[model samples]
Target: MIKACALLLLAFNCCAAEIEGLSAIGVGGIPMARQEAIQDALMQASLWNGAKVEASSSVENGRVSELQRVFPVQILDRYKLLREWREGSFYHVMIETDPKPDPVPAEKIAASAPAEVLATPVAAAAQGVLAKPVPVRECAQSDFAYRKKLLLAHFQLQNPADANDLSHFQDGLQQELSRMLSASDHYLPQRTVNEAAFNLQPGFYDPVLQPERVRELARRYGTQFVVGGVIRDIGAYGEQYGLAWGSDIRSGERKISASIPMLKLNGWMPAVAELGLKIKPSSRRFEADVYVFDGASGALLKQQRFADSATGDVIQGRDYIFGSRRFYETDFGKMVEQQLEQMVAGVDQALACQAFAARISRVDKDRIFIDAGSTARITKGDKLQLFRVSGSNQLVPAVNGDSSMSLGTPEALLSAVTITQVQPLFAIAILESGSIRPEVGDYVRFSMKESR
Candidate 1:
């Protein structure tokens, strides 16, 4: 059996042979074992039609060793997202691509989709294919070279539990989370974001205020996702095990136990007996809800609640900066650290499949420029796909509560280019294919599929 592979693992279990060519259908994305192994029969039939007829094979010891071809370019720049859907944890994206630039028809969208239309056919179709995808899917493995950009914004308190130390936790939240994701080596971290920059109050992402502001945040801060958090419960709550006998916890706490007088009369035996009458000790816990928003649209994408407990110094005050050495040394500090790990995982999972896109700042004859460079981990000779924004609009979920948002822009792939030169803030490239000349304000997207 022979398989056609892209630069990374684009094979997606799509194996091809001499007689059996690679199918236009690319089946990929593994969320769980049992369900992923069982591909949806309805989705399996999706196919791609391309203009290609090249397959080279090598045989070693009477066995086919390798099969190489360029049906789909080494970079997926030539591909187009055709369809996407999810069943349980399994999600699929069907795309059409070619060596030549192919244009998908523009779907008529106003400045924003009406909030009353839950799942507009146009919005449903544009889901991840055209708009920057949300609740993104991830590849099985991690990619180390490039780090996806993330902007950590404000976090709010659910209730004023007299935890004055947490009032300023927003700054600590930004600083610590920035440190956490940056340590993970999977995100380009920005932590100084505040409500002033986005022109909103705290928890704007909570109601999903002006969605266009996310695109502006992306443009100005160079981030793809905006994150916020809400502190729910961060106090001590008693545990009730009751020896697993289903005993009444309140009764246990109120049970009559031997006192010091009884201990003296019972010759020190009563004090020992009183220990069994005591209830379980209270444990300090930290509970918070993390909110993720698409930087392209202010739409809330994912909200995850995380809770963990520590044994000592779990509560913060006006003086404590979260994730500091003094704070981290305490039981509460460790619990917060653990929570940050999970938080980073959520952001990573949501963005792993979305392609990294950079805007074209200028386009000169035989020379094209993009706004990303070495800091983005892009190297020389890397190939990227060019696209022009046909137009854009705003999109909101239906009044009935559809959970999707759209940037409402249709794009046309222009050409593939190899990075010719690099700088700290920008990169230069020359077109390798296609006839549509690129202009300023166009976009170049990295073709590698694995953003983990």
Candidate 2:
């Protein structure tokens, strides 16, 4: 049997072996049992693929000594733990291994090989069969490395109760949303806003005026997008247990008394008391209205209502307790995490597809300044294209013959400019080519492959 196994082992190399066996082991108490199980599974896979062990022996007089030698093969990089559990006293694990593809063999051309073998179709197919595979791009990591800056506002509470609790909850909601976006490879950390920049009265929050106000605020922050919204409702609500009784205290002997008469009789009395109470687990519900704004245009790009609920199951003694502190352990936290994930995903898709543009604030000699800054992911050494309005109807003689107006295509005015400095709200760049000079209000957009 050993010789047969050795023959099989010699048939395949360590790097190109496929796993085909089962392994089970008794696992004792360990802090890292799951990790240990994975390791054991890997070991079994290695041996099943094509690993071997050998022993050498030497004899002198009547004494003999033996030494063991083990030849180990490399294991698969990708594998799945199929199942893991404890049967009676031993923990058993099963694994499925994924092996790499076999190497292609070189084709040999004979002197009398048919001309059809060298035909385009046959030749191409043969070359493809032997060609190295093209590497697949990892979009998640690449998307993350793309630089984009954003700003998030503290979401307002709509119809909020005049209490401090609601305020804290609102703050937490905004923080969690921001945290989700920060975690992605999509956008950078939110830019901090200087509150004193926007001083306003009541109507500034009104629907008719909010967009313009938000636009102004975005300009000050120098960001591409501003996230703002109101939380509609967020709190833990109670669910009735529905006519159920739980024993608060078990029945036991409370008191006993005994008396003995001189003749022969004795009597004893006993008393007991038990208490019962009603209890129920409370459920938490979180609802919020989320919105995203294009900072440059002050236009509402996206609005969504995110909601989640969970059973507040943390128990304290005989009663169940529910609060924000304990919410993380409940299902509500998972729901919130998932919702935030979707929000970040949406932002990434929109930013990647949207057309981005910025306006020149001013120009000084060869240096130019634009109203977009680091908040919009403007990085130093980045290149941007320049364009100018041309052939507008305003150029027509207004007096008699032609008074109508028509917008014209933007003419290429200048070559790409290299960004030199980036501030919170704007960036400075120097033009590298083209005769047309940049002026205030000229439109600028990122050069291809420059912005994420």
Candidate 3:
């Protein structure tokens, strides 16, 4: 797994001040909501100021132990808190920042404004998850023993010229993504059958994953995140005559690029385009959108498009079955594989800081059953923090505005649980601290990453 450094790279900044309005939950036991809102805004400001996220852990068996982040003092100093207000249980802050936006690699932060991301004390984000999470994690723990889950729902086609030839993309991409992620150390993937996977859709045109759709997916699949994609085009590149390949081959694969937008996270203002890959004249082109939805909130964490073109062996008709040896032998297969690699890399970065979560299936006496077990890599004797949310655990819009979103459910901590028995689909646990009753829909989460 790649350690994704979520550095906010600034572009050609004319030393212009930017306005960022961010929010967080102040309700319940969230500690400092006002500060969190301010910090959140600063994070964005730093991103635009070429800030990189990093982590340092000194706590071990012997020495005075702790996990911490060292922020870029200069970036923090540049942001001025314009104003702050509260609505219902949410705390909102509007900050004005001066940024010179540039996308610098995580390794290159030192030459510029060097600020490391400060991890919290309780390991609330995830165990040793150094990357900034793409989703909100108020009830998170840093536990390495468990890996976050991904459910590949469905891959769609955008009116293909050779629909049958590109048929493999509909489900093949899902299977292939599942295979790649399953082999990864950071994430576990839930395989989908056609009957269960076909119906799920992220959205069309500008996509927005609905909350209810996410809940249903979580209920049926028991996954932490749901991922889907739309194959926008796999055809010819406009009217330019191919330099080499047959007209039929060019017609099969779709057209894309020249001005392709990259990742477009919905909540944030302007869409982020890391690279605008261009397609060559008269070449077989492939382009698609990949989406990652949080099971907890159904919020679209990642929406990225990858475009690549090849001049040869782009399969026409159903010349070869997808993923078959013959298909892989073609240049088009290699192109698709390259995009899949990018897609998986994106998924890793999106989910890296997310905590491992399992739904409480049943509560009998002092024993608790969770939907994830050995199949999801559960081990006996593991301890997890338990919590009960006021409502369904999802991030929803705050009462008054859309500028900020809050975890709809104000989670109240319950007693910790010790895993005593493990199965493939379920695990049995008992309260480690108190003797109180928990509910079926409550959650059990690892606070930090732990050694396997």
Local distance difference test, candidate 3: 0.61
lDDT of 2 by residue, 1-452 (tens): 11111111211433543333222331213212333455455556555544434444566776777765443333333565566766554456565665532222223211112233323353435434333333221111123323555777766654454222222455566566667777664565463333311223444442222554555666666556777655555555564343322243211102222333432332232221222233443565666656666655455666677777766541222121222445445465556556667777667655654545677889998889987778667788766667664433223232453222111123554555778999977899887654657877676764233212
Report the Cα lDDT for candidate 1: 0.55
Tens digits of per-residue lDDT for model 3, 1-452: 22223333333342556555445552212224554565566666655555334444453456554344434313333455677777777777777753333444433443333223323323323233443433322112222356666788767666555355654756677777888887776577876665232233445465444556665786688788888777788775444423232232322343332333333444462333322332333457788888777776656676788898886556545656676667767778888788888988888767765768888989888789998888778889777768876655344566764422333445676766778999988899988554568888888876543222
Best by lDDT: 3
Clashes per candidate (backbone, < 3 Å): 4, 1, 29
What residue runs in model 1 are displaced by over 4 Å at the alpha carbon?
1-145, 160-162, 166-168, 196-206, 236-282, 317-319, 394-408, 433-435, 449-452
* Top model number, TM-score: 3
Error of 2 at 262 (Å): 35
Candidates arranged by lDDT, highest first? 3, 1, 2
- Per-prediction TM-score, please? 0.55, 0.45, 0.59
Q: Which stretches of candidate 2 lie over 4 Å from their true place?
A: 1-145, 162-167, 189-209, 238-281, 314-327, 355-363, 369-381, 387-415, 420-428, 433-443, 450-452
Candidate 2: 10-residue stretch with minimal lDDT: 1-10
